[model samples]
Target: GQQVMQIPQYQHVQEGEDFTTYCNSSTTLSNIQWYKQRPGGHPVFLIQLVKSGEVKKQKRLTFQFGEAKKNSSLHITATQTTDVGTYFCAGEVTGGGNKLTFGTGTQLKVEL
Candidate 1:
């Protein structure tokens, strides 16, 4: 069984400050998916990183995949209240078929 873990389980940032969360996997991953879950809501797919050393950006959010394909990170520029949520990284092991292992998650809080 593979596991994915995220650092800084909880993060508090003032509005307009930058925030980042790191995710590491126990084994090499074929792909990784990022999701955001708001309070009392279901997880919503944000994006997926497949290529090693891949980097993608959506608006003020940036995502990066490690060259080894065993780690990833998410960064947000100018944190806002709307960014409050639990961020999760799900990884699919190189030969694990369609199964995905989710990380412990990082909860982000924004304050004015």
Candidate 2:
């Protein structure tokens, strides 16, 4: 079975600082998705990547998928109090059912 792993399980950033998180998969992934979970809130889909070596940006945030499609990363240009939340990366394993395996997740805390 394929598994997804995330690094820097937790982060503490001062407001206006930058933050980043990395994710890797044990096997090639068909596609990968990113989600954000605010404190005391449910997970919310942020973006999805299907092509190798793909990169996408939303405002001050950037997402990247590795050329091997086995790794990914997310970077935030600047940290804000509102950015305090957990970021998760999920992917579908090769030949796997329509189910997704989620990484451990990176928890972000921003302070003023």
lDDT of 1: 0.97
lDDT of each: 0.97, 0.94
Question: Which portions of model 1 miss their true places by more than 4 Å?
Answer: none
Clashing pairs in 2: none
Tell me the spans in candidate 2 whose CA falls farther than 4 Å from its real position.
none
Find the 10 residues in a row with the least total lDDT in model 2: 91-100
- Evaluate residue 107 in candidate 1 and report its C-alpha lDDT on the 0 to 100 scale: 100
Clashes of each: 0, 0
| TM-score: model 2 vs. ground truth | 0.96
Best by TM-score: 1
Question: By lDDT, who's the top model here?
Answer: 1
Residues 3-111 of candidate 1 have per-residue lDDT tens digits of 8999999999999999999999989999999999999999999999999999999999999999999999999999999999999999998667799899999999999
